[model samples]
Target: MEAPALEVVGLGKSFGSVRAVDDLSFRVEPGRVTGFLGPNGSGKTTTLRMLLGLVRPSDGRALVGGHAYAEHPVPGALVGAALEATGFHPGRTGAAHLAAYAPQVGVGRERCREVLEQVGLTAAADRKVGGYSLGMRQHLGLATALLADPPALVLDEPANGLDPEGIVWLRGFLRHLAAQGRTVLVSSHVLGEVQHTVDDVVVIARGSLVHASSLSELAATAGARTYVETPTPERLAELCAERGWTCAPTGAGHEVPDVPAAEVGAAAYAAGLELHQLATRGADLEDVFLRLTGAAA
Candidate 1:
């Protein structure tokens, strides 16, 4: 069996009096897209830096493939990471920028061009880094990370500058990577996008692990929320008020907290109101994530 791709054991960091990351422990398994999530200032960047050996942890350790990153002879081949998209030299062309990192990972010029094409930047390979748009820089960052064809990937806010089309493309790309038995850990604030991308998640808040589980399990624990659509929304809302159930008007319906569809149907029937639609929504990752982080904060 293969080993866990990424491991964080009692990982922590501090800046003078401030503790950035507390005793955080989690695992990124092989062949899965795990989302590392938290609110702003949640120590996510610090944690990633520690994993990549860019920052020294105040205590604990981070490892890639069962060994400390520093212990790996060629860390780049074990894990490819991009914590930010701002490292390129302004004067270098995209292809040249990638070529610069190729030697560091034991690759060559052809491999650099291959990754440029893999990231769909081949056409603009000669464009100066300074003139590249934010989205293009993101692609270049990904290209640099993939230059070595590592088995694991760690990305932070990778979708930040991408357009809608780019976001869709990245979603498919990450999924393809995970499907190939590669591990992927991504941190992003775009909850909606993450919802569709990641298979599992490890959420942190205030430098502590808040929740870590499969996305399906997180959604399962959110319980159920029911939506009712009626021609007389005001009347139905009035009935809901009498029943002490919170009802908020939606686009063409009203969202009621934790009520079953049958109950909603019965209420409409009792009030002689015609029901247009009655549906129940399960808890989504975004709702659960916000609730967890908000409470922790």
Candidate 2:
């Protein structure tokens, strides 16, 4: 069967006087990894909870497979979710935890073994979850989510505690899942953190949707800039200012933003400034994200 799209339509939630999520909307389609990004306390978790039916939304609808999570007859088999990684009994072995929840997912112990191996936790299968590192715990949570072989996945901070090697593994693993036509939505507090992992991005701030677009689209709209090093920095900055370009201070030199490298180079050469080094800086996803979500402030 084809994977179903995950949709949030004007979703909102209020906790008495405070609103957690406000009129948010976006879609996650199959065969792509979508990064759900926002700063901490920006209602990312609340929005996800509503979609998973863990929390009720006061205002709109969160749908999986064209139905609310509660409406699905077998939601687990349709959308696998690993919301958090610490929900395990301290004394229970990883394998044992899987065994305990296997019935709830309508899968037996054998399926548990398969998912354990799939998430690279086979060797640590017998180890107590208490002894598992945060990265291992993350893999365990993912293994549990995969137990039912769901077509779409919703993971919150799957890469949060991973080390360098573990992060590389997760990036490849998520891409593989999407390659298999699964709709994958992974949440994080920063866009640059998941910049290379996702095909699309949906960003929110203060409980409201701020930006939603394909990864490439976001990059294209970010407006690449030119970074240049010069001995006469003041002159270059003045030149950039004259041309209406914003020259941000950088470690090596100044970053003339929103202007092409060729244009900057011509202007510098025309002004008789000796260029020590010049390079084009690609779109900085984190910078763009901060500006969009107002987190930079």
Candidate 3:
């Protein structure tokens, strides 16, 4: 197997008295999209900063293809990252904006046009950034990241202002990058935002690693469940305890994992309890995400 495109080993960071990222470890392999997930202020940005060598880590290490990010002869060409999308000069045309960075990225001015087209921003290339819509600015940021055609990508909240249609376009674009064997790591606070686009997930909360696994593995771990909504939740709790079944309240309903709908209905009936609603459900991706991160709905 190929070596990981990105790796974090026991990574940690501190801002004086406060801890930011705590003992996190994960690997981003080539040819896949990895979702770096957590709620707001969960150290997602700090972790990314440390990985890019923008912030010094207090402990451990963050590596890009086996070396520290700054160790590469041309780091931008090895790993393209876009941590923010709004720092452009208001008066600069999008094409000129990329042209200024072309020399820094060791690419000629023509590369800017190619990336603008690659990110579907060719039509807007001549427009000043101040007049661009948020989604268009996002596309420009992506174009900038692709300036050198890097084999690895790290994007933070890349879909912040995208409309539904723009989001759909981005999904296809990121998938295309990964299909070409580039490693991709994207961060977001909402699981549903990038759920369909990612192949794996790494979740963190309060600066600590919570869960990290393949998306399919996480789904399989959640298993199947029967969702039941009844007024007498106390009685349903009893039935679950008696059956040695683990259960939890999933908003309006109680989800009994690994238990069939028939079993739950039969148990409620046998106990002479009233069930207003009962149905079989596959594990909900967002529900599992909330549980993994211990985040409130």
Candidate 4:
């Protein structure tokens, strides 16, 4: 089956006097992982709910392959979602739980076993969900999402209760799903994990879109500042400012915005300023996330 793209256009939701999501718009292209991120109470959940048709939107639309989630003839075949790992019944065994939902998606019992094995949950197939570990429960959630072999996936914090090893496994699994040309959108507050897992990012705060861009672009934009250490800090700062560089004095050294280390070193040497250290203080995704979200607040 061909992979489907996800699009949310001017999506919004409100409850009484509060607006949970406001004019949010973003797209998740096929064959890549797009991370949905925000601070607590930032409407990430509300947005995802609207996307999956679990919540009625006050305005706009959420579409997969040019159709709303529930509009598809076989929505399960179009997209699979695991919004919460605790959705399973405690009394039901893992296999039994999946088997119960298989027919609803037009799959047979065999598909349950296949997904259980794929998620490494075969050994715990008959174990009650109440007896399962958090990681094990997360695995079961993933198995449920994979049951129909859908072309797209929507997961919310799939790594929340995972161990270090489980987190690693999930990263590879999501990447593999995207490699098969499936569109994947995962929401998580763990910016470090999302940094390595996703190809693109959509960040929201206080029910509004704050930023949306590819991971590389965000990193590059955040890392535009370089650090320079010189004995004549004030002199170097003046020199940089005269050259049209925005230079600021930092605790460790001087920060020159958008100036390369090579250029800084050459200019400092020409000005006879002894440099002790000069390097680029490259900003990672965490830096970008914090700055954007903090500003949004």
Clash tally, candidates in order: 0, 0, 0, 0
TM-score between model 2 and native? 0.95
Candidate 2 error regions (>4 Å): 295-297
- What TM-score would candidate 3 get against the native? 0.85
Better of 1 and 3 by TM-score: 1
> What does candidate 2 score in Cα RMSD to the true structure?
1.7
Report the lDDT tens digits of candidate 2 across residue range 1-297. Answer: 589999999899999999889999999999999999999999988988899999999999999988998888888888999989879998999999989977767998889899999889999999889999999999999998888999999999899888988888889999999999999999999776788999999989999988899999888888988999998899987898788889888997989888889999998889898999889999987888888989523
Candidate 4: global Cα-lDDT? 0.88
lDDT of each: 0.87, 0.90, 0.89, 0.88
Candidate 4, position 166, lDDT? 89
| TM-score for each predicted model, relative to the true structure | 0.95, 0.95, 0.85, 0.86
Query: lDDT at 17 for candidate 3?
Result: 91
- For residue 254, model 3's alpha carbon misses the true position, in angstroms, by 8.3
Q: How many backbone clashes does candidate 2 have?
A: 0
**lDDT (tens digit, per residue) of candidate 1 on 86-125:** 9889999998998877888999999988999999999999
